[model samples]
Target chain A: MTMKRLINDPYDVVEEMVEGYVKAHDRYVKMCDLEEAQGRVVVAKDAGTKDKVGVVIGGGSGHEPLFIGYVGENFADGVVIGNINTSPSPDPCYAAAKAVDNGKGVIYLYGNYAGDVMNFDMGAEKADEEDDIRVETVLVTDDVVSSENIPDRRGIAGDFFVFKAAGAKAAMGADLDAVVAAASKCNDNTRSMGVAMSSATLPSKGGPIFDMEDGDMEIGMGIHGEPGVRRGKIEPADAVIDEIMDPILKDLPYEAGDEVYVLVNSLGATPVLDLHICYRRVAQILEEKGIKVHRALVGPFACSMDMAGMSVTLCKLDDELKELLDYPCDTPYFTQVK
Target chain B: MTMKRLINDPYDVVEEMVEGYVKAHDRYVKMCDLEEAQGRVVVAKDAGTKDKVGVVIGGGSGHEPLFIGYVGENFADGVVIGNINTSPSPDPCYAAAKAVDNGKGVIYLYGNYAGDVMNFDMGAEKADEEDDIRVETVLVTDDVVSSENIPDRRGIAGDFFVFKAAGAKAAMGADLDAVVAAASKCNDNTRSMGVAMSSATLPSKGGPIFDMEDGDMEIGMGIHGEPGVRRGKIEPADAVIDEIMDPILKDLPYEAGDEVYVLVNSLGATPVLDLHICYRRVAQILEEKGIKVHRALVGPFACSMDMAGMSVTLCKLDDELKELLDYPCDTPYFTQVK
Candidate 1:
């Protein structure tokens, strides 16, 4: 047996690491004690106008700053952190929503995954039964790879849009229904695709979560290190960017004069230069196609630890969506907004 | 051997990683050339000047985002990255110093090690001769642990003050000489001590860079994973913090009403919660001592890869130092700077 072959159980590792993680990053977050705050995302009491709409988002634990990282801004009232991509308990979701719920109601946004849906849906039901709160769901299905082979694409990292739109609406004091509608619209208009030169080692195993050769990469791996659409020889950076973003552009059938918010996400390992180079080229490609790119983000947005690769997510937008996308935000991993 | 590593050639790993390092984190850094700029820190030419003084700090490679990571507004004008603390050749240091020599003249701040002192002094001499620049230097010697009760106290992880004081001064634009003087002052009042629960593993090694017992850690390990003053069984978190910070606080001869800047640096493997919990007790101790801590930073600044445990650095500051410490900065490994 390999030396690192963990002595304890794998199931126990997440909780242990998170315990360590929480201890380390606790400066940035407070794991909502389901027993205490119930469903609020912010550790403190509601400071944002409760009368305005509320945005809620979340998923598994591995995406440290994603769901939890986005909590401080106007984006989400709460983000339910669970196991790696596994949904949090209904209690936590319900508590987070209930905690943030104003007279206007709450909007729940998330990546498209069976577990998140089931658990979040349950949480919404629980919130409804306990308080006079209306909760709506908007699922982000951005992974073009999962969608290529499968009819329903697995949600990757495009949930960022839902948060932006919902947050903008909430910040504007829009009604809960309007917030939900805007979030849903953003989700529908968004699409993403990713390529990975290597798989992230499971935090527990400390080895490849999945397998690939030294020179090979999966052209459409999921955020959870899920299997991608195509596995082949590693290609040039330019070619890789094309491969990753082409489908995202096409699936949405983006056309000339259509404005969109583009994000080139590095899933760990891939350095900023590589990401910037890829994004610079990707932007040029879209520019050649006459796509009116309003804004762009290239960084480690949603990362799989130590995985060397990238994902391209584009959200087709108009004036309303663009404004929402430009809203301010502050979190552990992301910031700009007040 | 345990497999899975991030670098190729062990000898070239530091340099190779530095290449990707600058390329990856140049977002906040306005100007840096990895290929030509090798061997020294590269500062942005047009970084906004603060009315306060400016501080320039650096060290070796592999501790990325540390030396280079803090180069931004109110932080550092330039950082001179050494070859894993071996100190880059004098030319690169001069080049870097020139790039960051805001009209105020830049202070070359760093740890107080023989290699660093010799190289920086040489770099300073070169800067003076070639560019009509007068550079200042400060050596950080915070380790209370002697090399086995010897006279030599190798500079440990407390170089953080060099960055803070310089960053603060640079933000204020105190002109080069004043900033240099202030940074030197901060260093004079600064002291640090560290303990490693385990050894840091280099990415290329796929094994610990140094050996240690599962239940033991060196109480005064240096940033390069050098042996500490003493090795003993791992103790409770409270005890660990006391052991690390108590000596630092005492060595500074800290008194009541003295304001200070506190930095708890992780040698890598140490998780966040433990750092915070360490902070919790440490903060209380300082309060009881009647020290007015104007600013506090608790995170991984100078890391020893994934080495578990932490170090504490305390810089006794006056009002001028407080003003400098309040400056804003942005880099990859650090954020929430205001």
Candidate 2:
């Protein structure tokens, strides 16, 4: 059992985590009890701005500070939680929309996955049927390596940037269609690539979700042990970043004279020391390419439990995107300063 | 080797990390190169507040946000870097004071350790003799389990609260004596205890810093593999918190009607999910004791770089301590909204 997780009962992880999260961040969020939500929804206490569209985001657990961590002022209004790596049921997803809607309508945003799409779509249908509240959906497809086609790529850490942009738009009183467009536009421009040196430990499984040799690494690996582009012996930090950046750069064709926002994110278990070392290389690469780094974020924005690796996310910037990304927002895990 | 860390050359980690940190947080800090300071100091760009005492804090390198992460607005103005698990050299310690000092004076705050004391003292002596800058020191001895005598106990996560108090005082234009007094008072009221399930992997050694079986855990362990009070099989989160909180509470004698600032810190690989679960119990115990939790912080405040464990720190508070703790601060790793 290479899994070194420190959880108590495997079955109680989600509930306990929810209880703990709300208690620690009660100033920002509260537990919501919709008829069939089963307490799986955590909504921002001050949600439902009078004329603003409600922003509801969610997905599986284990990725702390992702869906739930983004729920706060000027961010997502609520988050629907799921079990470890599993999608939420339809009821909670529907309840999330019902919880935050203020007559301007609601938007459901999540990473692109078969399970999440199915569940959230069912939720949206239920919301429209039961209350006649319109709900829009935006699927984040930002992992450039997952698929070559624009809409098929899976979302990874790029979810942070895309969600922030859309949330900012919604907070600014954008209508439902405009908010969806903002999210879709952000997703289209964002690109992410990651490498995993070790698999994340699953609480219930009581072992590694997948296995790799001690000195090996998988480049372009998905957050949930999904297959990557290549597996080989682990390389130096510089060499690894070189390998990762080439594809991300070419996919977007991020060229000279381009300015961008950067996010060098830890998958988990990787220390801040190494993340910065990785960021140093990223900055050097961007400089060499004649690209200007507008603003940068380096930490565990999205993580896969204690997985030992990291990812680099680049969101090419325009005036609107920059303002949205830099908007002041606060949550337990992330805060942006004015 | 169960320990898997992602870094480049082990010997160059400190230098590379410094390079990465300054670049990633260019908004708040900059790398300093003082002729006598040996280029191991990172100072806040907004340091050198006129008429205010300079606050310099540092220790070994493994604790990421602790010694370095807290150096910014209204906090420690500078940090001296050291090798992994080793105290910083005398030159850099002196350099940090020189970099941040304005007209008033400087205050050096760090955990009570022999190596840090010897090195920082040499630096302070050099400052006084060569430059005529008054330098004062306050040793934080908050790890109640490290020793029965208050001054002999080691410093741990409580470093955060103490440094913040002193830094806030300095930023408020307190002279050196007043700043040191504030730091000393915070240290007197703070206590911490931690459990390590697995040892942190040494970058230079390429293995665990110490030995422990996979199923085993040590209670009251210090950050750098110091001997703990008890070793036993892993327990549930509640039971483990019960064991940790008993000593901390007893040592401080935190009583009913008292208020405290709680920090449930992940040593490294423990993740936020588990930290919150742990915080739930800490809150439960404090509530049952009629101890009012003025505020709570749960996350990887001080980490051991992928070491699987956590620690709890409580600063029994008064009005002064509460005001200082809640004072506005902005750094890459920590921020306060007020």
**lDDT score of residue A239 within candidate 2:** 91
* Residue A31 lDDT, candidate 1, scale 0-100: 57
- Per-residue error (Å), model 1, residue A144: 3.1
Question: What TM-score describes the B chain of model 2?
Answer: 0.98
Candidate 2: tens digits of C-alpha lDDT, residues B11-43: 888888888888888888888768776768999
TM-score of chain A of each: 0.88, 0.98
DockQ of 1: 0.13
Error of 2 at A91 (Å): 0.9
- TM-score of B chain for each model? 0.86, 0.98
TM-score per candidate, in order? 0.74, 0.98
Residue range A1-338, candidate 1, lDDT tens digits: 11111112445544543443343334444555557334323431343345676677787755544666566555566666676546777777887776676677778888878888898899889888888688888787777767555337777768777787888788788887787788878888888888887666564564567777866778888877788778877666667777777777777666689887878776654543345556666676887999876766665567664566778888999888988887765554565532
* Docking level of model 2: medium
**Reproduced native contacts, each prediction:** 0.01, 0.48
lDDT of 2 by residue, A1-338 (tens): 44565667978888888888888788889988777688899999987655799999999998886878889888899999999888999999999998899998999999999999999999999999998889999888888889878788888999999889988999888899999988888887899999998888888887889888887899999999899999988888999999999988988767799989999998888887788889989999999999998888887789998888999999998888988888888777777776
| Candidate 1 lDDT tens digits, B79-154 | 7776644666666676676666645555777766677678778777876887776787766666777443322566
Task: Show model 2 residue runs off by greater than 4 Å.
Answer: none
